[model samples]
Target: MMFFCCSFMGAVAQADCLNTENLLKLDAQYETALQVGSVQFLDKLLAPEFYWVHNLASLQETKAQLLMRIKKPEAQAHQRRSHDVSAHRLGNTVVLQGLSSVDKLNPDGKTLRTSRYQFMRTYVEQQGECKLLAVQTMKVWSSEGN
Candidate 1:
């Protein structure tokens, strides 16, 4: 009986792997929407109280403010890519860390503002469903990019 219990526990431990592929897909959708200057996906993904901080050290932006910005004509040609994603799950909390590159095109694409950023996201299981709770980002210039 003890051996059977140990085997069951081992199986449970192995099954705890967090499937981050879906999260990566969501990240892709977000980037695609940003490149297309469309806020549709962002609107769906961001929580009502979502907050975002830009790499330029600007103030945090709420979901409504972000939506407004993305809807403007000047929002075109913004591209982003996420890499080196690391995800961890502990009990009912999940954390995601990744590196990102962001580029916003200028009038001639010659003045593109590019930067490398690292982000940490936390999700909590609320009422048996996981939902994003907070996110933070930091900018860095690295020769060996992500």
Candidate 2:
């Protein structure tokens, strides 16, 4: 009985893998949510255990903290774009890697700050839906560019 139960759990886990296309779609949705500062939209995409490490920092922000920051209008991204993004699938998880660029603008329509970073995000199937699990990023470059 124990062996059968374990086997069943393993099969269920194996069945939860997401395809590359779904990963790309989810990544797009996440980027749009960040640009628009849509906390409610992001809330559905990120798993409960999701955490992000920014710019190779020791500090890690959990899902709630991330959403809280996104909810603040001042912290929103004016524009964000991804370049050279690649996706890899590993069993039940999909990893996305690429260079991400973000722009911040002042109320006067001048560029306040521009930043670029290399980032990796992991997504996994949870409760029959694809959910973002974790993110790690390092600053590739940044420019005031004003």
Candidate 3:
């Protein structure tokens, strides 16, 4: 219930990541899905062979594992947002760099802590659509009561 709705894929199929506006929009949708545990939406956002090098988990995880974890209520973040979304086009692929902010809150909806993560994601454009290829993330830092 913490995450918002996940009807954002319409733009994903049409707007390639090479367009910064589209990239940022998808980025927002991605974070929103994570916060809400929208596994169905995530399944479509990821490519067939998508994988993630997640430092928080200390290992590489496949798309299936990622989706399974999202089904657990504990995996959903109280609040999550990604910023500094920059796209660099490389041939038909785009490498995106961004910082994600995750806030852990108490029952009163007050943030008890905040964590920042740096992530690099790859998107391969094909047939006028951008497919998410892979993502690597590392926790940059954490602060109390942010």
Candidate 4:
């Protein structure tokens, strides 16, 4: 079975994006929230109308659905490690793009599977904090034995 994992890299100052630092901080917080399945943190970080598109199945989920899904007892726990993360500013919105490796875990917390993915998350400033607006992800298919 496949699952989701959240990961983030440290902030890198960028002149092009004025809110790079703030965005990076939010990103890290989001990763932590996902890692630990903190519904409250996700509630604060995601806008009411936030939408997420999964890498596999093209499944679309709302903030509420995502919260409920993650809160399930049988939900898989996994770790994500991200790299090559970068942020771009588009008007008042910030788009974070990165590559992540997700390790699916068994009941005992042992890794069962690992997959690579590329994702883009859009964020906007809301109430003096960054909130996720939308997210799109695509799995990176292995090219081995080609």
TM-score of each: 0.67, 0.80, 0.83, 0.76
User: Which candidate comes out best when scored by lDDT?
Assistant: 3
Q: Give the TM-score of candidate 3.
A: 0.83
Backbone steric clashes in candidate 2, count: 0
Off by over 4 Å in 2: 1-17, 106-109
Model 4: pairs clashing at backbone N, Cα or C within 3 Å: none
lDDT of 1 by residue, 45-101 (tens): 556767777665566778788778877867754567888988887877677888888
Would you list the clashing residue pairs of candidate 2?
A: none
Q: Give me the overall lDDT of model 1.
A: 0.62
lDDT measured at residue 29 in model 3 versus the true structure, 0 to 100: 77
How well is each residue in 102-141 modelled by candidate 2, as lDDT tens digits? 8878667665678898999998887666778999988878
| Candidate 3: C-alpha RMSD after superposition | 3.4
| Candidate with more favorable, higher lDDT: 3 or 4 | 3
**What are the Cα lDDT values of the candidates?**
0.62, 0.76, 0.78, 0.68
Candidate 3 per-residue lDDT over residues 1-146, each given as its tens digit: 22333445665666655577777777677788878888877787788899999876688878898899989876788889888778888688888898998877655665457789899989787777666789999988888522
Best by TM-score: 3
Clashes of 1: 0
In model 3, the worst 10-residue window by lDDT is 1-10
Query: Which wins on lDDT, candidate 1 or candidate 4?
Result: 4
